[model samples]
Target: MISQFFVLSQRGDNIVFRDYRSEVAKKKDGQEEAPPVFNVDGVNYFHVKVVGLLFVATTRVNVSPSLVLELLQRIARVIKDYLGVLSEDSLRKNFVLVYELLDEVIDFGYVQTTSTEVLKSYVLNEPIVVDAARLQPLGPAAIFMQGTKRMPETAVTKSVVANEPGGRKREEIFVDIIEKISVTFSSSGYILTSEIDGTIQMKSYLSRNPEIRLALNEDLSIGRGGGSIYDYRSLSGSGVVILDDCNFHESVRLDSFDMDRALSLVPPDDEFPKRDNLKLK
Candidate 1:
């Protein structure tokens, strides 16, 4: 369980702080320079960085490191989803909203709900929108990109509760097929190893909560060699793609997956990964 939660700026300023259990002492100056996770006087610290700010949690009990780290990340994402932009200025401007979110997300050091949709009814304060243009550039790279003809930003940055000019919520959903590929080559310039890690991410702004149907390639095969689970064709063919393993969210239905290689489900109102850890070859 979390004993305390806080946000620190890059310069070690405590921007937002909450002591649920009051088990940990007040943070000392320069504490932000410590490692992401550390232990001092039987107290454990876990923190995650997002947009140059630190989201930190403290505890005395021995909790799962991964679980605490993921909680920090999810908390950061929840704040970003509400504020539309995550920065020190934004957090300062919407501190009331932030505190309200913290109250709903955690109950006296115990996690309640991190889902943005679930928190909507409980979070009474409206977020103060931050103008992305007025903020300082993230880094030198951001300045360099300003002159380039970049594609329009995706809906991911928009707040889930934001309304249009006529108080109408846009009915749209976004699906992203993100993949990371790794390749190793021998000194002879021959490929020694190649693999792909992919995920299907989804975010919904639709109010009706309509069911979604997502179809995969007909020639897609699972596993290696001719003994693949889905297809009988050889994997050496150019048109065929092979996936060694994949996992889906609990909300997904696989009734037609065996025959049509399709997935059906009603997406959650907030952003979530529909599929994860897809190993491809």
Candidate 2:
């Protein structure tokens, strides 16, 4: 069971702390209780560090030591996605997001969703960036609906050359299809085996819970091309892409994928990566 969670700076100052139990936060007379010493006689403390901040989870019960450690790493990733950077000042400035994420990840010291991709589905807000010309940083709640912080004027012009003057380019997410082709050949050059391993990597900045449909030319049949609905005639007629041994993020509903023949997703917000893998013959 988890007793407390803390985000400590490199110097060990508490950037943010939360007590999961009510008694830990209050005294017998109901006055506020002081912070617990990180090292207690019987408790075990697990720590994970990322980008100069330490994430600590303390517990008194018997639990998988590795599990608590993994939780800290996942928590840090989700926070990094939200804040774009992790540091003493960044966590301090974005304390609310940290608290909100910690609550969503662990319920009363039990591990909940450790998938940062899934966690991003619940955590909506992102850190604020401001006008670059003035080089002034805005307050944390300031929303930026336009493109990312200023690119070089030349780079910006190059990106939107097709747009009419003064038309800003839409900030669309980028999806990367990475494939590693595996092939074998005898010294005589006769092919023995071949397969394709691939993954779809997405860097998203869409609106809250944006639904996406990814259409590919892959010939998809519940069974095989022998199915009357997708017979050899049709398979040979249209250019068909073939996929084998595919996998998807847990958020992807199998029923929808089967019905639509499209990869469906509610994409995560800015800079979060969603990866799905597949093998093709």
Which candidate tops TM-score?
1
How badly does each model clash, as a count of residue pairs? Answer: 0, 0
What TM-scores do the predictions have?
Answer: 0.83, 0.49
In candidate 1, what are the lDDT values of residues 92-145, reduced to their tens digit? 999999999999999999999999989988887877777664434558668756
Task: Report how far off residue 92 is in candidate 2 (Å).
Answer: 2.1
Query: Superposing all C-alpha atoms, what RMSD in Å does each candidate have to the true structure?
Result: 4.7, 12.5
Cα lDDT over the full model 1? 0.81
> Lowest summed lDDT over 10 consecutive residues: which window, candidate 1?
226-235
Q: Residue-wise lDDT of candidate 2 within 1-281, one digit each (tens)?
A: 78888887766677888888643332222233323223445666678777667787777776777877777777776666556555676677767777888888888876688655677567665554211223345566347524555533222111111222464444556666677778888999976766567777665544446677777555664324334323434666566644545666655555556565777777654333344433322
